[model samples]
Target: MSNNPIPIVDFAPFLDGSAKQQTADQLLGSFKSYGFLYLTNFGISNEEVQEMFDLSKRFFALPHESKMLAPYPEARTHHRGYSFPGREKLPDAGDVAEMPLPSVKETFDIGREDDDSMLNVWPPDHILPGFKELCLAFYWKCHEVEKNILRALALGFGLEEEWLVRHHRMPDNNLRLQHYPSIPLESVLTKKVARISNHTDYASLTVLFQDNVGGLEAEDPNEPGRYLAVSPIPNSVVVNAADFLRRWSNDVIRSPMHGVRAPQDMVTEDGMLPDRYSIPYFCAADFSTVVDTIPGTWSADYPKKYEPMSVGKYMLKRLADGY
Candidate 1:
């Protein structure tokens, strides 16, 4: 809240050949600095964003039994469907032995329905008419935005503009709808539980649309132990580099740690909490795509820091560790 910590970038220039390079440079600077950026004029409209949020609210409002029709374990195989609150805990950077605090959030996950291996789970059409279609429409919109960003990122890294797009043809991207329910004041003040634990995303990039009730925070790039509030910006989407990108870039780009806290002003006079909603599109390359350090990202002094791994294997390992 102090001073919008993340830099804002206009994405419209990326479409024009004359201004494309400048836009790519700005994106590169933001990636190297905070690994987060607020993007506006990216083609997805404000009305579309609101529609997605409304649909998400409706989905979560369904009866618990109805929401659980697509439950975990079965849902875990394809990483789709509903996950109740308190089911996930993200451990800190070190000390895996230490138990992690359970996240105070419920999530519904969906992936590209076209992929047989990553088919999505949906409620009955009669239960929520047009829910699947609307959600998929939003998902593809976000994915389109993601593809354009990746092209700019490739330019940022001095690689072919199509370097990333070619490999990500059939990405294992996911659309996740997160709901952080309100909690009692006493529990919040004393327990210090966060809606989500501080953690880095496991994908190559993430495009997020969050409602006005802001609580997202990104770790300061220059100052450790300090964080910058990433409040929602009107007509913009928050995009961040993730672990895979950092690895692929040979650490030239960072995947900063981020978490969600309950908004202080969200508590009512009676201490009731407000429900917070966010939709994040997690983008990654194809499962069989082998990810190694990209060209021109490594030097003799700064050698390749990670071993090459298939995208699918690495993603599965990260998912298993967290879920």
Candidate 2:
């Protein structure tokens, strides 16, 4: 209900190269400070955003049997397809044992159509006409925007513009459509369960589009246990640093710990919180790319903080942990 705690950064200037340096500075500053920022004019239109939300609702509304046609594979590295509610056990503050609840959400995941490293699972065309075409188009749209953001980040880090972009040329990203169903608020308030437990993402960066029924929160960097509300702003997308970037930056950038809970105003007279929807495009590098501290991020005074790992191996480990 209060004003959004995260800073807003316009991506138009970055696109036009008019105020690119200033924009890059602000983007990087927000990342280092809050690990999140609101992005506007990032090339995707409000109509397109709403369309995706509509598609997500339609997908989630399908019968359980119908939806299960494209089941989330058991293979640790196979992340595409539909996953039912309670399928994920998200960690709280990096510790899964501390959380008693399973994430009460269902998800539909998609990946690059041309990504030869892994194939995406999809419902039959008759099950959802035009679904694949539209989703694939939107996936690439997100890809283009994220590529530009990476370029700007490279500029902010004082590296060659192509330094970060080159590793991501394969577009091995994941597009996730998440739906949190209405549930009794008391369970969450009592800490017996949660819509989503606190945890940081595993991607290099995440571009999130959330609907106005807000419950999303970002942890306060200065106050360990405190969380600040990230209210939805019309037509704006939220961008955040994620774990891979944290490792790559050698702690120069932070991967924010965030989660969704029941929003006070949205709770009904019967004590059920309304369902919420979000579309997050998680950006990742090519599977074969070996991620280590970037050129300017380490030195004798602050040595490399993490061991080098290939994206494929890292993803497999993280995905295995989530379930």
Candidate 3:
């Protein structure tokens, strides 16, 4: 595995503000160097994290037909909604045609659950009581964790604690619930390439809450032949920066590219049932925000390196291909 290893930052102090500046300094080092980290010790509780994972398991357990009722094709939510395993594509890949075999997975892409404007398409009330409420709570909690990390990131960058976060007000965000069907050791896995293949997320940072069973890998850019397994650190949110952030940082940080290959034990509800779950929260700037050069982030020699981009358009395009 190449790319200098992704750093690790202990957030326990940042959450409590003990040696606050010190914590911020640690954050700066990781973001500036690798743009990815395994953050152990934050304010979010294990029970809360478990609750979110459980909710996702329940949601993804529904019959395939039942989950398909809420497609985003006509909803016009910038193409956001419940996505079947094969319906979505990674924007960077550009291989949108159907594959001989479909993805052995299912998912629900959700954002700000409590915000009235961002309502999720639900299975009828009779089918699931209190489901939406639970998801909303999870979203809110993840948002809290995300904010704490962002503040730490801002301070690490030698800026006001709130400097980086303010741009995310009414943030561009999504909480995804993924269920990778378990496969047998001997069987060749089946997969369909979506147009948005193998790409880095475009958000400022992504927080992944993974289960003990691991498959998440970061492609080693320096040595494409190998992959570094991102081992699950119980209760820790695995955060990584996107291309936009690396560009904003004037290439100081690395925007990694990764993907989910077939899991080893995915039965219908293996990850969605009594056990197995991996949930990730992606955070982005509000669509209206300008994602040009990050303020005070450039020098005369590196003056404003990027063209201005509408937060929504840049991301919408990424999502169109994959995010």
Best by TM-score: 2
Query: What does candidate 2's lDDT look like per residue over 63-84, in tens digits?
Result: 9999999999988668899999
In TM-score terms, candidate 1 sits at 0.95
Q: TM-score order of candidates, best first?
A: 2, 1, 3
Model 3 RMSD, rounded to 1 decimal: 4.4
Candidate 3, 1-323: lDDT as tens digits:
24437667788888777777898787767666555678888777899888777777777777777677765444434444567665554433313363333334567777774455556666666555787677767877788887887788777777888987888888568887777654442332323332123557776788888887766667665676465667676667788888777776767667877665444444344333123467878888777787667666788876866778787777766765432
Measured with C-alpha atoms, the lDDT of residue 3 in candidate 1 is 70
- How do all models score by TM-score? 0.95, 0.96, 0.83
Cα-lDDT of candidate 2: 0.89
Q: On TM-score, who's better, 1 or 3?
A: 1
Q: Which candidate's lDDT is highest? A: 2
| Candidates ranked by lDDT | 2, 1, 3
